[model samples]
Target: MAHNQLDLLRQRRFLPYFFVQALGAFNDNVFRQAIIGLLGYLAVSPQDKTLYTNLAPAIFILPYFLFSATAGQIAEKLEKSKLIRITTAMEIAIMSMAAVGFVTQNMVVLLIALFATGLQSTLFGPVKYSILPSVLKPEELTGGNGLVEMGTSISILIGMIFGGLIFAVAGAQGPWVAGVAVILLAITGNLVSRAIPRVEAGAPDLRINWNPIPESLAIIRLARKQPAVRNSILGVSWFWFVGTVLTSNLPTYAEVNLGGTPTLYVFALALFSIGTGAGSMLCEKLSARTVEIGLVPLGAFGMSAFMIDLYFARSGAATAAGLTVAGFMQQPGSWRIVMDLVGIGLFAGFFVVPLFALIQSRTPRSELSRVIAGMNIQNSGFIVLAAVLGIALQRYLHWSIPQVFLALAIANVIVAIYIFTIVPEFLMRFLSWVLVRGLYRLKLHGIEKNVPDEGAALIVCNHVSYMDALILAASIPRPVRFVMYYKIFNIPVMSWIFRTAKAIPIAGAKEDPELMRRAFEEIDAALAEGEIVGIFPEGALTKDGEIAPFKSGVERILERRPVPVVPMALRNMWTSMWSRRDGRLRRMRVPRRFRAHVDVAAAEPLDGASVDAQTLEAKVRELRGDAA
Candidate 1:
């Protein structure tokens, strides 16, 4: 059954981990903000304040660069639950030290504590993500990631708000109050971490690498070997890069361009965060509870569009001073700016959730944590580079911040084109989404419980149209290897999509024995690896919109390697423009149907040894009924 994203919050495995991570994020930001606020309260020199403020973010992110590789190794080598508990304990200790620094006003202790907190966060990063797949079902992964992203965003906001408010109200004793609060939060996090179920080590026998630089490079190399994992890492890192540029400039942008005060800054941040939370929650609905990469392209488009609009919205505006939040809200064109920020964030959620889910779902369990760690390292690198690029563009190139927004927006287009081109699977999936959801309304019957969520199963469906495979491909959440006639597989524009999807192209034994042999061999290999394989028993598109006679190929394949066989039927597709009812070539001359209704019925899996091509064909024919 499909459950709401919020439903996971009630489960023990997910809820405990969620709060622990949320509190940890909350504490990190609170402590960091408390330090900066303390500096301001002390009336520190502007030069010194600037130096420390600049150094704070760098110090915090440095651990991701210095320790992420090692973190991955440790996470893979140790039980994740225990590791998380240990890391949470470390957080408590670090916060205790920070509390001392806060009370004594000791800069050294505070900075050291800050670095320690960063290191602690680095250690926790791998375990946090790697444990999810172990705890949740595959169908729950998208929802799980959505909740995590939403939690983190909201936590950052709350941390900032409370950290500033608490420090100000406490006055001279503010640090002491902040210190105790953080330590308590850390302790609470540790207590929650104890409730997380133990997950076995991913790579228990792997050797640990002590060195950072070479190990980090090696980890990245290992992740780069898988094209999907590598591209997802790039996409995720680019998100952080763009996000850092936009967020880091908000304070100055609000003051100089919009003439807003601190409250307006908070309002803008809230809009972005709220938009992200809303968008993340919407991913499951948009994807029908699947990890849909199609949303990524859609998100990238929205992010770029809103960013470009933001550039125009603020462009050529007169500078204003002492604008309160209420005053800014009352100004002309304020709503446009607000909408642009929110829309950018909303699309950002759409863009990011799927990439994270893809990384989690696609990467091998043994290497998932390491890949995520490499992603963290790259994310940090991109964030730092964004800072540098922003500085250079502003100082050397003399480009305004809004102009930089324009430049980044343009860069996003190039990045999207390059990514989509390099891995056409993303674009192919987007097209499949369009064809299945936009061009036709798909209704699935008995698919939820009938189709196994994991493991190898053979799906046998009656072929009614050339688009049968594409429809099934988009409809099924798990990636499938389709077995299709070689000629159809080689269809001009679709050949690229077929190849990208790793569709197996087969020929009849009499026509081309070699291709048939290879196709069966590929099918066996795919099923052996626990992948789903789909085949049409009729071996051709229907000529009269009727079920064709069953062939012996299915029986022969099952004899070689037995696996459960699922029977499916596609109804109401024979009259579609892509169908062969009017003759394949003649159908192409007909106008394409839009918003056609298609029903896909999948029955329970039959024992492979008991089922043959004839029985499966009858089952599918019955499932199809008189719909055609």
Candidate 2:
């Protein structure tokens, strides 16, 4: 069954990225189409094609390599919320410039407009990536990246189609509609960007270096110092490499290699981008919102494998390589290429999404812009290199287009092996991933009734054993803050889990007075801010089949905060996971009810202003009431 990745796309935070990108895409298409149409119109008229058509792309792309170094430095040096706004404002200016060209009917001015748009995009490159680490969690990184990429490709497709239709239909009056459309979309993009939250730049104090070549190299060097970060950036760069090669040549490939009309180019690009969008959203679902680095190699494997198959699908056909959209659909041999191309696009989703999450999770927040800048540099380098490779292999090497594609496919495989070997995190995750396949089927009873719908509630649960926190964390959709013992908080691998969950650590008053005070302070602060905070009152491990005495500590907490207390009982813990023989040995096996029932019983708000400790203890005991 096909998974629905679109669920993640519905998030309010993601909407801005989607709208902003789509509008930007629409504008890009409007501009490109204006130029392309003008050239095509000139083909029949007196104007020369070489002057306008050849110059547009070069003018646009030159800014990325030229200004990316400075842009990266600026993104790192300023607050990201402001930088994104500035970039979008730049878009407004760029679009306005294009509007002038369209109104004045000057090709030279329009060419300059394309250059301004590229410059805006270049400045945005580092800011876009760096901001994600600040806004999203580690697990969300890959899915977010995927969505951004998918949205971008889809926008490109829409833009191209829109641009052509508008130009072909508008005649000499084309620029007015196109210009107005670009300005409106750019304005919309700017508005959406204004909603983006502030993100701290990684290197606020790092000195700006104006020289693009040297600064770009230095950013690259700084990025490599972090191993995992460097690899994740490489992963993204390679994606751009593959993507640019495909996007740049697909139209040419359809026209020259496949003997197809211009319409098929639209079909091919749109389908591929749609496939990527689907894949990006699916990453969160596939990885369960964790850093599933393992999928990196898996995606690479499929990408390479499918590209080779696409090559095979196209090779045996003797018919026209490119066909009109209608003509291509009618041919049997061409359908194989179409299906193969779709598959290639679909697999791209799987391959690229996780890398985004990895970068966010692994890189230092302060150096994120520098790291992202390094990534952009690599991406630009790869784009140029891939274009060169694709064109050179086709023209100089005398290789068929399909054969050159085959070389790229094989290269993906080789790169996959090299990357996985260098970073075992990807491979190691696949091993543990098998356990996740066991499937967690939930059975709920009185969960909604027992758990408070709103208001601050201090949950007092009997911490029976393993995964107590994980179960509670997963069960409630609303975020919860758990006040855990410092000992448990410092547990070797669990620290990261605790950190991500935003767990607060508490120590016994005698053991550490300062920490205990901090915990209480945190409790009051959380409740005052109208957030949910939980506490487990049973101070120590339940060694035998008996409830430990309720700690007076909870009473003290309630006295100060005066919030409701939710009493929770975890079913079947002592029988399976209690530490009986010191800390080294285990007790009974995990309960047969591994999916045992849990009841979060919310009693009334405590009588904090007047109640004695004994009264509060009695209230807690009544709530427990033989539940476990």
Candidate 3:
């Protein structure tokens, strides 16, 4: 539907939903920050302030652990747009109670309302992520999720700034200002939610389990059912952990390390938030509008790089005390610190956005809501653990903020390695992503439109070079089990990547009949499972940059399984380094077409039942045109 990520902002389907979610996040932060402001206004004892501040997060997060399972079922059973409206409507009631607490200066009432706010958020959680897949096409998931994350990041930051300043500017009128502001924001969210177009329930006829404990376990099991999805959920929780640790330390870090006033703490947070927002928005462009999980590894390493630098940038106390934001910026190594914070946030965005998109795209639609619910439960645990561990490391172990950061950076690398090791797809994708992007400036034509988004399909493409499979895989949004030549599949370093990608290795029938039969069996199994299978119907790389006669293997495979066949072409790859144009020894020579412009085009799918190998080859030839 939407060609660009920004274009979605102009459409009613996404725009209204985006604003509603952003408004809800804005109001949530405003309410919480206003409570802090209220405490300051009353000039409560530091002990009391510490008590409330510490207690608030636990209370807010508890509802996620308690009610998220039920919420997930409800989300699956109701129309998505209706569920959103109901959540926004609930927000109005919850924020109204918060308003009363603000005006009455009742801490008990405020805390009760805070719990209610968390309950509302818990209920909204599943539908928040689940609705995107319903409204957006597969190709739009990354961009759409990017916008949502960006909006949330910016909204929370701005809401904190606005809510925190209400007390400073309004002083005696602070309570009234906060009360009115929260209620108005809630109402606005509700009003905007009305414009979100109706989307059908993910599992309308499904029965709900009212029990939280068992349902929570069941949903978590469901989330972990797929290895990629499971690892992705873990990655998302890790992001939250890193975020909590990094953000929670900023106040102390600003004061102790930078020798800056309280205002500098906010300034530091603003930089991280802005960088995160920028990174979130950039996911679409970086991913080429696909659900590119390859960015996850890049993001993780980038985050670690910045965080480690932050420790070395200034590992000790400030040279001066009580400097303002401007004065801190004027100090030596200050710009490096600023760059580190922004870089950390920026990479954090790159890390999380693709994982969300992957979860949505890969999970079955009927179970997506509950899966998201399960992820929320795990995320809550991670946030709590990060908070506790951060405090313990600093308070009990006597680790400085910089030391904690350094530890976190190291821990991040460990976690990343563990996840990648368990599910090498993330790492495989990353490697292929780098190989393709580094070698060529690739462009796609009719891929999103012509390739099947779901269901088993056969893709027949002319084999131009050894890198064709990776290039095609990178260009296409969905995973394709390429039927690569067995030798290429067994190549020294590339073998591991191919095996990890689950590429089917085939031998020529004359060369090895048994292996060829086994390859066909695997191909059939993959197609039957509703997975895409790709074949170089030409059977080998073109020797003279011309299409070889299509082999009968495609027809034989199609006869056994009549799935749709998509004709695809890789252009300008024949002259690439891996192509047969250069002899073996000459292949080692320096590449001349580095970062060459390459095109991958897909024609509309042809019915496998009727199309023979020759017709498919003609179609691919047409798609390839004169590019080779």
| lDDT order of candidates, top first | 3, 1, 2
**TM-score for each of the candidates:** 0.94, 0.70, 0.99
Rank by TM-score, highest first: 3, 1, 2
Tens-digit lDDT string for candidate 3 (437-548): 8888988899999998899999999998889999888878888999999999999878988999899999998899999999999999999999999999989888888999
Expressed as tens digits, the lDDT of each residue in 94-184 for candidate 1 is 9999999998988889999999988998999988888888887666788889899999989998898888776678998887898899999
Index of the highest-TM-score prediction: 3
The 10-residue segment with the lowest total lDDT in model 1: 584-593
Query: lDDT score of model 1?
Result: 0.88
Error of 2 at 206 (Å): 4.3
Give residue 74's lDDT in candidate 3 (0 to 100).
Answer: 97
Pairs of residues at least 3 apart in sequence or in different chains that clash in candidate 1? none
Total clashing pairs for each candidate: 0, 8, 0
lDDT over C-alpha atoms for residue 522 of model 2: 90
